[model samples]
Target: MAEFKPVKLSSPGHSDDGIAVEVLPYGLTIHKLLVQTDGRIHDIVIGPENPTDHVAQKYTNSIVGRYVNRVPVGTHSFERNGVRGDITALPNESPLVSLHGGPKGFDAVPWTLLTEKDALQLFSKAEAARIRAQPESSFAVFRLESPSGDQGYPGSLIVEVLVALISPDHQQKISENTPQNEVDNRVGSLALVYRAKLREANAVTPVNLTQHWGFNLEASLNKGPETLSVKHHTLTIQADKIAELDSDSLFTGRHVPLTPAHTHQAKPIGKDFPEKGYDDYYLFKDDLQSAVPTRIPLSSFNDDSDFVQDLLRSSDNPERGLRGPPAIELASERSGLKLLFDTNQRGTMFYSNALAKSSAGARKKIHGGSGVSGSGDAYDPHTAVFLELHHPLAAFLHTNEKAGEDTLLTSEELYHNYVRVDITSKQSPA
Candidate 1:
């Protein structure tokens, strides 16, 4: 086992409103996300007490790729050379499926930091020779020359990831006399942007990548009286359909309308935990694109009159409907903490951390200097939730992109995906 060494990065000059982020080379995992709220600081993301524990635990705050979610284990048929052929994938934890790119996937390996300027750029490459030699080990095909017979797939691949954090201008906008309502809206807003690009030309491959960052809005980095479980947090997702899962927890390739109980319309998480904890994929509503005017092009309108009217409306009220409702929102009334998630991905996996355990000495003391001591505590089910954004699992199996389609990526084209997460504080109702 390798020892854990983490590098901490903060905003220039350690601004009070800025966030302190920690990353580990192993898995290029985000170990901590600290932000100031009220008079105290909170680590809203769930993480292991010890950095090395990341390897033993599930993909927490790690970059999962190659294939983001699940694929059938063993040999599976894929399109190659315009003919159906078989490809083998590595299996982990489950014999019937390969998860997060198998046991040795990107989440389980170390990534090199290519640059550290306005954003963090981490690079990992899968060499054709190495991938061919280790057919049983999981490997990333993007941003690498996979070649034919590499991981039972054809062609080479190349991929790149860029991560950036944007903080609000609290110093300039926030003042001592700032209204409580205004301050509530201004403070604690942190934005995380994840952008990925496939860099191979004339190559076609299955590429789905996502970050696994769990949130406990009311939770504290230091064990103290303010620490609260996520049981009381309210959740809302702008999804009307969810992917169905089988007994083994793999998607059954079916989509079902969400029942009232499963609908996340600002409902408390504890109310639904008894009915099988949430580990399902929520499909974003089709009309979500309309919420943003930029996504609605002039060509979408049949007549010049309608197009001109819409253009006027959009320009006259640029910020009017932009802040409607996010794809997902999680809030804790007790701490007045709220988190909003938005993404261009088609699906978001909502996992409630039902399998976490505090036993076996897996727990450790909190980080930072808060004068709070450890109580040998364990996290209960639903104490935290992970929202992973990505395309539908096994989408390549059903997609047939034409040569010039914008959605289709050719050797000269690139696939770019983005997800934004914003953290804010809201005032409790009077």
Candidate 2:
């Protein structure tokens, strides 16, 4: 791990009405997201107090990749170039599963910062326009290259993450030169765009990346004597079908209708949650793209959109290329804070921090800082929730036909997906 300082990003030229963020080079981690709502600034994203603490906290707002979730051991063999080979990933979880890319995944590695010139060369004119439309937005491009067989993967992979903070006032710039119906209305949004390419032409490897950032909306808004937790947060996932999991929490290769407990309809997170909070994958039930107006032309960025489109158009089945809705919502009533999640990934994994222990000792050095105050004590079980967007777990073990398209990429194809978070105040009119 490398020691890096925090890079501050503020929208609207550091005005109080916009969003501010902090980033670190280690793990390409998001240190803080300070959202101003109702005259108060709330730090919606939670992690360790100091920037260096991120090295020990692997998944705390870090870009988790190569493979997002658990992979059953012995299931590493894949057919590439008409020949089958095995990926010998370390068994980090017990002795049967490799949890999070074999221990030292992308989250645990230090990524290099890409120069603005090099980063701009990767995009087209239209994409560059979109990037410039964000006024006073700070852009940080983090690059990471994973060598072939680094973690038993088959090919060398290069990945870049673009973190941008689009202040609320930039809506005017983003909506310019667009039809009234095609405009994007999101405000105070943070865009995290991930792009990857395999270094070898004949090599094949599994690629599913996601950011495992936990959210405690009221972490900085608690002013009363009572403590705040994520139990009071209301959630709504736009999916009716969920992936079935066995006792070990691995995918069972079956789809099950969402039960009442798992199904969310502006429902409070605390009610009907399992003993350890939610850790389930939900499959979308509707066509998200149809409802979402295409803006900025993502296909121009050399992403896997073409491959996914071909799959959607080729298959006669309506569910062949199902994706989550443009936005999944979570709200905190106490703080009057609302978070809207938009992604292009296949599905979402909702995980509440049910098994998290106290962080008071680790956060002791960051108490009473400038932005927000940390309790330096354990809030409770389910203190925060993680909404991760990525391909299905263990998709690398299955073929594209079985796991849908773009689950694994070829040498000629580039991997791209994004998760955008838009924060606003409930007190404001919708």
Candidate 3:
């Protein structure tokens, strides 16, 4: 195994523009994400000090997969492409349920950092064209090859993750002129793009890759690395329905309308839910528009010269790329920071770290102090929130086929999805 090394990225031409990130190939983890806004730098991601700590503390900002969520013991078996496989892997959760790919999922393994040339092939045709047009953007790609039967999953899976950071100024094409009003709304952002495929011919497998990151928008270095609880943050989720779960928190293959308890419309995150905070899957409504409207012109990024036809095709093929409305919006009045979360996935599993407790473990720091935790620099319950983007919970269960379209993969198809976070500062005009 290659030694684990951390890679740092910053927005092009402005390394100090309050945008910096550190990523580890181990588990494809995002170790640090510091964004400057409101004249302060905020380390918004919850992570451990040592990159190796991710192996034991897997929930930190790392990629989770094979199957992203839960898989009941008996429902672990699947049949696809006329082949059958049973995932008898040891269960990590109670009641013999497999959680996050049965312990040694993608988060527990090391991935290979692909060279620029090699990674170029992994980017979608539209993304490749976009990257070519914006060479100044900062991005890194990591690859992982999972052999058949690893974690009891069927096929050999080749997965690639592209993490990219774009500054507010470059959110749109460089050739376009920005209006003053639009410039104020422009935000610095980070996007994670995933691509996966079966390596063996006719092989079949269940794959649900998702990025798990606990965000603490209250993180800040304005007054010497001061960190606050996420309870103070207000949150909104654009969904009309939520998953119905059993007592053990496993999906019950039923959907229910969002109740006041789970429905968030700019509500205080800490006070809106039950004592532990929300830990449920919110399904996107059919009328939901594509997440976070962007001026990047995704439809025209194709290489084809038939612009009109390409646009029409892109409209018809919503699944081809990132689509869906800003699934979540979180903001902190104190920090004057707002997080616009969007993804192409069907739903998001929202967790408020209800069970998380202060740890003695080391954490990443800036300006000689730590961020993303409550006072005393310890992560307490409700200090951070995780918005896991992917298919519905337990999508691998054959009974929930309709809930998960692309979770079951065959050699003929490729897996693709993305999660984009736009961090904008809502500062009052001086």
Which candidate do you rate higher for TM-score, 1 or 2? Answer: 2
The residue-by-residue lDDT of candidate 2 on 1-430, one tens digit each, is 3436777787642234667788888877888878775567777776777677676555878888788888786546776335444578678776877777887898887888765466543444556555545443467767888998877777888887778775543333444566543332333667777778777766667788888888877767554223246877899888887877777777766667999999888999988988767888887655653332112233344432232222111112211222433447887777666777767675788989766666432332222223222344643457678888876777656453252532666565566677676665544321
Q: Write the per-residue lDDT of candidate 1 for residues 7-40, one digit (tens) a residue.
A: 5655421234445667776776778877665656
Span of 10 residues, lowest total lDDT, candidate 3: 307-316
lDDT (tens digit, per residue) of candidate 3 on 234-313: 88888888988887777887779988888888988766558757788988777664543111232333444221112111
Rank by TM-score (best first): 3, 2, 1
Decoy 2 TM-score against native? 0.81
By lDDT, the better pick of 1 and 3 is: 3
| Whole-model Cα lDDT of every candidate shown, in order | 0.56, 0.65, 0.67
Query: Of the candidates shown, which would achieve the greatest lDDT relative to the real structure?
Result: 3
Model 1 Cα displacement at 297 (Å)?
A: 19
Superposed Cα deviation of residue 53, candidate 3 (Å): 2.7
* Alpha-carbon deviation at 119 in model 2, angstroms: 4.6
Can you give the lDDT of residue 334 in candidate 1? 65
Candidate 3: where are CA atoms >4 Å away?
Answer: 1-3, 12-16, 80-85, 117-121, 124-133, 170-185, 221-227, 289-325, 363-377, 398-406, 428-430
Candidate 1 clashes between residue pairs 3 or more apart in a chain or in different chains: 142-158, 142-159, 143-157, 143-158, 143-159, 144-157, 144-158, 146-156, 201-411, 202-411
The estimated TM-scores of all candidates read 0.73, 0.81, 0.81
